[model samples]
Structures are given as structure tokens and as C-alpha cells.
Target: MSDNPAADAVLNLVKQQHDVLEKMLNNVSQAGEAQRKAAMGSLERFLSAHEAAEEAYLEQATKNLENMQGWVEKLTELDYTSSDFVTRFGEFQKELINHTQTEIQHTIPKALRDMTQAQIDLVQSAFERVSETAEPVE
Candidate 1:
């Protein structure tokens, strides 16, 4: 939606983050007891870092942080093996994916509409700064 190529590039980066998050969620969901904790930690760290990048660069795209955090908290309290956990985690994944898509499709573009070139560059710079540090170790 943004006319600026820089904004478009940032949107692409954001989409890549969503792709990574989706993979991480799948990893956590499929992880065995021996690996679930570490997998979840990596997912949580990436989620936190992704949110931080958005908050720092594009506040309008992060309106659901509190809601997402609530889901994270609820999931943390239940056993991963429980049926309820699976059900709720599925719902959480759906919501998070929806939120990310919305940001990519509408929110970030709308925010970029009002910004100058310099501001857009700043957003790109700031987002990369936070996001690069949160990349998971393979």
C-alpha cells in the first residue's frame, strides 16, 4: 500500500518475521518434553523482539500487544500436553497470524502514509536494530 520502496521493503521484512514466527510456533507445538521448554523460550524471545521492533518503529501495528501477552500468559500456565493447551494454543496461533497479516496488509501501510522519507528510513533502521539481535540461534 505504501508508495515508498523503503516502506515496501520494511513490509517484506515484517512478513519474513511472521514466517519465522510461524515456524517457531510449529517447532514449539511439535517439540517433545525434552525440547519444548527451549523451543518455547526461543519463540517467546522472538515474539518479544518482534513486538519491540514494531513498537519502536510502527506503534500503530502493535495495538494487540496486550491481548497477545494475555494469550502468552495463559498458555504458560497450562501443561503443554493438556487438550486445553492444544486448543488454546491453536487459537493463539490463529490470532497471532491474523494480527500479523493485518499489520502487513493494512496497519503499517496506513502509518507509512503520513510519514516522510526520513521517518520511514528511521523506522527501517530501528526495526533492524532490534530484530537482528533477536534472531534465534540454530
Candidate 2:
């Protein structure tokens, strides 16, 4: 479930980080200053990692797909919850679900489906090769 073949390994890594990210963001909303600070560190790391991955993704994806990047930027900017861990995790989960739906139902498939077999092969080979060096997101 964590390893995504359609995306470059970087984005797959980010997607795999989702559960941890959700928990951290939720913690920040519920905990005191000390706990919040710890959660912030986790959030910062997730943000840094996801941002770096997204920037790399721009190179692999078609220009049209950069809009997906913009959406992710907005998503990462959102406060997962305002009052409590439950609410925050809920929000984060909802956003992740929505974004995942879009990626699977439209974005990634659209990019590949429009390609010729040779082009698909090229992209698939590149993904497999890159995946060899990257950690499994799941």
C-alpha cells in the first residue's frame, strides 16, 4: 500500500509519510507547548521532506501536472485542526483522501494513459530504477 508505482519514488515517500504526518499535526493541536514544539519538529521535517520531493517531481511530471504541486502546497499549508487531535486528524485524513483520489483517478493515470507504449515504458523504467534507491513509503 505504501509503494506507489505510478509516481516517482519521492512522492511515493511523501504519501507513505502520511500517517505519521497526520498524527504529528493532530498532536500539535491537542498538546501543551512542550508537546506542540515536539510535534512542530515532526511537522517541519515532514514539510521539508514533502517539499523537496515535490520540487523534484516537477522535473518528472509534465507542466500540466504542476497544478497538482500547487494543490499540495495549499494542503501542506492548512492547519490540520484548530481545537483537538480528533478534529485535526480528521481534517488531515480527509485532505489526504481527497488528494489521493485525485492523484489516482486523474493525475497519474492521465499522464500515463496519454502516452504511447514506448513513453509509458520510459516512465515506468525510470520509476523502477529510481525506486531501487528510495525507501519504501509504506
TM-score versus the correct structure, for each prediction: 0.88, 0.43
Tens-place lDDT per residue, model 2, 1-138, is 223344444335444454455555566556674565556555655545543443443333344345545544554455534345445445655655565555544565555545555654555554444434443221
How well does model 2 score by local distance difference test? 0.48
Each model's lDDT comes to 0.80, 0.48
Give the 10-residue window scoring lowest on summed lDDT in candidate 2: 129-138
TM-score of 1: 0.88
After superposition of all CA atoms, the RMSD between model 1 and the true structure is 1.9
Q: Across residues 95-121, which tens digit of lDDT does each residue of candidate 1 receive?
A: 988988888888888888888889889
On lDDT, the leading prediction is 1
